[model samples]
Target: MDRETRLQALSAFLKAKRAKIPPESIGLAPGTRRRTPGLRREEVAQLAGVSTTWYTWLEQGRDIRVSRSVLDSIATALQLNIDERKYLYDLTLESGSGATLWKEESPEISPSLKKIMNELRYCPTIITDRRFFIVGWNEAASCVFLDFEQIPFEQRNMIRLLFARKELRRLAVNWEHFTRGYLAIFRAYYGQYVEDEWYDRFLEEMKRVHPDFDHLWQQSEVKTAPDVLIEFRHAKAGKMMFHLTSLQVQGSADLRCSIYTPDPDSPTENKLKKLMERK
Candidate 1:
């Protein structure tokens, strides 16, 4: 990423984090009315033991040198967790004046990987690249979600489907919850490909199409792959719950396989069986 973009990302992330903190929780009195949510910039500076001007400059994305201690203090003031702290450093510290390493093309799924996906009998599995393009999926996945084969190659992005497809969005019981985590994961990967044309194009299109997406993109939250329990309301099977797990492919760092396995002792397994039978 370029210095300017890196600075902007850092600023956005800091702002977003700051917005989530309540002044009273930090032992500060809830003062007069404010135009926005969370602690003000000056309040953040005070908490971090920095001058208001310096903190303001940082938020303004001004070109200035900052120390590790200051960054640490700011991170603490923002209540950032381990992954978010690492992300803050990645955006501010690792960024330098150089071209980002770009892949010539999207990573292709190897034959073995496809075989592995195909072998997943009961679980719904899907393979995606760094940009979240749906490269392959199993029959169970299609039966539960929309069939990837029906969508055009260019429109097969996971993020896009989550936002734009009404059927899929309706199926996800915790749509907002799932989308926020998904967007954070996407933002984490996006840091590595800020200058890639395809990434930029896809992002722009999403922003244009979905106002909610555009709003959330400004939050600048970053997350690695998530493993969590997700609930779905399938049309044919009623309510179902699964443990969503994501794993990197063995040979390809940029490729990932996400699987949804029915939760133990849940009706999801029986529901999935019925759904598959109907398929």
Candidate 2:
């Protein structure tokens, strides 16, 4: 949708949703002789902890910059569900303002590059685009975590896998901690392509399928590329510790290669070796 139309729809949608919430529902007195059926513009602004003028401007469809935090507050105040909240973001956040963070076409992995990834027998390595779509992975990666080759291409997303896949959750020793960091990085990446179709669809599908994602997403956390120690509980290998490293592919700025190396001093190294031997 064009910017103007998006803004207009945002204004209308907010007003409609706002009207559905009663003052009594939020522990506010329903003042007598109310001209409107629901809360007033000022009430919404007050509840959302934003300025009345700013809320008014938004309701009027003014071309004002909206932050994710502010949108979260407004959505909360309006009692918006996941779908509505997503719609609010899509409408208010104009896509034209941000730089294109993703390529129009997915990058192809050369046979040589694929071979190199596979040759990293000791390190579990996987390649993904900016959007976290798995482009390629080494056998060690499959042995360590999931066999991405078995998953459908459309569902081969790190974020989606983390949120929607039960096996990954079970495998992670620190699932919550790991996901928080992972999501923060994902959110930071998402900011670069808030208006992109792939992002839009990804957000919608995630929110629809994983209820927890919406709550976490609304937190608006952000983090840059991170290096940390991760522990995974493999059914066959037991608990394994790895130092994770994320690096940008040399020529493909949009693509990244993540390698997990077993801690040299820890038993994780021996465990990985045995896992590879078994494979």
Candidate 3:
């Protein structure tokens, strides 16, 4: 990512993170007539022991040199968790100019990876490129999610599926909750690939087409957690719940292997078996 774009992303991330902290959590009284959500910029500046104007400039995406110590202070002030703190560092800190970023080209899924996914007969598995485009999948994934085979390759993106596909929206029991987390992950990557125009175009198109997507995108929240619980309302199975776990491809950190395992407490396994039988 370029310096300017990285600054802008850092600005947005800090604002989002700042808004999540409650005043009372930091031993500050919740005074009446407070308008902004969570901690104010002045409050963060106070907590981080920096001038409010300088912090304000940071949030405004102005060009300024930021030290590791300052970043550490701000991170502590924001009460950032490990993943969030790493994200903060990634946005602000520069690797050497010789350091390589992930290539924009999609990573090729190896035959072994394909075999691994295909062998999981009961688990729904899919492989997504860095951009969250579906590159490979197993039979169970097609049965659980819609048949990706029928969709055009470019349109088979997870974000597109979530926002554009009514079928997925209908089946997802916790649509907003799921979409927020998914969007947050997407936003996290968006910051890392600031030079990619595809991200810009795709985001604009999504926000234009889907109001819900626009609303969520504007929030600027980010999450890097790989595990999520998803509940789906299947026509034949009634309700099915799955724990979705995402693993990084050993040789390809940018590629993600996501598996949907049936929740032990639910009838999801039996339902999936029955549903797969009809396939």
Candidate 4:
């Protein structure tokens, strides 16, 4: 992105983050009925230990050099989480070094990783690209989830399936809760890779097709890929729960392997086994 465009994006991101924080959260008393939703510009400048005019200029998308220490102070003032702080850096920093680890091109899975995935007969494992495209999967994954081969290659994205396919949503128990976390991670990725035009196109398509997507996107939630538990109401096997674990491929920075292990507390194993046998 050009300097001016990047500044504009940074401006929007800062405004969004600022709007979420309440006065009471930062030990500031609600002195009066505020004109704006969040902590005022003066309040943030005071908290961040920067001049209000300078901060205002920064927020206004002015061409100003921001130092790391100043950015750190602003991050602290905003109470940014790890992912959000990183995103903040990616936006303000000129080098864009924060996003250096991510590659825009499609990732290639190694033979060894493919072999390992295939060996885990009981575990439903699938590999996804940076955009959560289902690039690879095992027989167990096909059995547990839908047969990926049946779907068009272009429609293999996890987000696409979750929002577009009603059957998948129906199968997932507590779909909103599961998808919220997914969306949070996706948002972080989108912010870091703001230069990617594909993200904008995909986002526009999603907003047009799915009504709930715009609402979720507007929340500005950021999250890292943490282990999560998901329960699926299978038509044939009945109730099945799995603990989802995501791992980054060693050599491929753009790929993530998700393995679904049956929850010990539930009868997911036997049900999965029986379901796999039928397949």
Candidate 5:
């Protein structure tokens, strides 16, 4: 993990990924027919405020020194999060540069949250930590979560579920759109606290359990709180639509409450009510 060549490989990979980002994506209009498929070297150079030669060397995996200012500029230009930025630092740092020590914290959902889950058994709600760990969930969330009691409590991660569960993929009406935001939320939360071993463990599990997620993560496409839309085949109301609303806990910084809502005038509301009434 602390190898120079490995860091170089990561840098080269970033350079390649950055090269494909279109100027239009960053509000810079495409000027004319270009040789490259994505943004030109000079375009990123101008935005990043570094010599084209240095950035070129960075892309080529050549030896060059990086300044904090320039690195920050590049991070902003590439829209890298704390993890991705840390990865960049890891890649560019000299061997034995001493990486930031990642710590392990409980960040578990509170007992009150557990009680709330029990009381709100009618709604499919979950109480997760900053790292998206499912510390508390109701029977309703379990039903929606699709196998709550079976999966290891530690392995009950939202990102892992999106990739590992066949029902989550097949049953979710708009999987691609819904799943895209999970990483965004993950990245955004992990950005604030990068030293969590649990976060790394979750990441490792994601890479091992789901190759598709691994590929996307490697692309360094960090998402920052995206609106999530999940559709379901309701037992009573037929097809349904659900949107998750996230809110930070008032006192505890680590916890967040995510409530699922049905689209207005949609069958999902009625279906949810029927499901609740049955139990």
Candidate 6:
């Protein structure tokens, strides 16, 4: 209801950004008279599919509730790039804007792909869409997820491991700094997908299930975990080094083929080999 700060910040950012642009740069006629310069407020509103009054209120730091859809449209109108778009989204959230983005996308990885995952049963694998929805999981993944199964599915977000689950938190060697960067990396990779219903539900469920995770989420820091230090507690091996690999699924922009490789000499490789032999 009261998102005045976001409106104000965005207004300032837009105003500052807009000032640098000349009307001629965008092919607009250099009107005979201009006050604030660079394509008037009316022009911006028209281009952004918003009413002039709405745009004015937004720039003036007034209380204006903006939906994610409208923000996307405005970002498009302003020609924001990936980082800029995310920053804009963050600004709104920082201002206490409460419209959570949670769009749902059905699992779409192929049955053939599932078979491929089965073929690599020795390797831990899972399929997640852009919004972090877990569509599929191989045996290795099942162990980790199963450990956390008591947590509600809607809130089974990966970020919770950093703050909520004490055991998992212990697994992360450099918890504090690692989390700071990982949060940003998460936003960079997943912020674009946050407007989905599934994502919103995921956050809500996480907040309900683990208040600690919710606290970290509120901090809004973003970063990615380092590749080398991440270790996993294996059900069979006790503990193992996992190398995460993500292969982009062509044609489907959101789908990623994620695989985990245990260290060659680590007990995991031997354990996996034994499983394959048993099969």
Which candidate wins on TM-score? 3
**TM-score for predicted model 1 compared with the true structure:** 0.88
What is the Å distance of residue 262 in model 2 from its true position? 0.9
Q: Model 6, 1-279: lDDT tens per residue?
A: 223433544566666555655888768988888877766877778878999999878767676687888888777766666665776776665532223432344456687888999888667776655555456677756554344345555555556555566765655445664454445555544444433334455556667986665555554443332344346654444566667666656554456666778777677777666654653
Tens-digit per-residue lDDT, 187-256, candidate 4:
7677667666566678889999999988777677777676888989988888889998877776645677
Instruction: State in Å the error of residue 273, model 5.
Output: 1.9
Worst 10 residues of 5 by lDDT: 94-103
Q: Residue 222 in model 4: shift from native, Å?
A: 2.0
Model 5 alpha-carbon miss at residue 269, Å: 2.1
Error of 2 at 123 (Å): 1.3
lDDT of 1: 0.82
Model 4's TM-score against the true structure: 0.86
The alpha-carbon lDDT assigned to residue 252 of candidate 5 equals 46
All models, RMSD in angstroms:
2.6, 8.5, 2.4, 3.0, 4.9, 10.6
lDDT of each: 0.82, 0.78, 0.81, 0.82, 0.64, 0.60
What clash count does candidate 2 reach?
Answer: 0
- Cα error, residue 83 of model 1, in Å, equals 2.1
Candidate 6 Cα deviation (angstroms), residue 64: 11
Pick the winner on lDDT between candidates 2 and 5.
2
Question: Given candidate 6, what's the lDDT at residue 139?
Answer: 74
What are the per-residue Cα lDDT tens digits for candidate 3 across 156-203?
A: 899889888888888889888878877777776775555565676787
Give the CA lDDT, 0 to 100, for residue 99 in model 6. 32
- Please give the TM-score that candidate 2 achieves against the real structure: 0.65
TM-score between candidate 6 and the true structure: 0.51
Model 4, runs deviating above 4 Å: 1-9, 30-32, 35-38, 57-63, 94-106
lDDT of 4: 0.82
**Residue-level lDDT tens digits of model 5 in 1-279:** 324444444565576567668778988877787766667777777888887887777777767777777888987877666656765664565322222432245455567767876776556777676667676677667655565768786677777777877877876677766776666566555434433445565677677867787666654455444446668764444687877776667654456677776767667666666676675
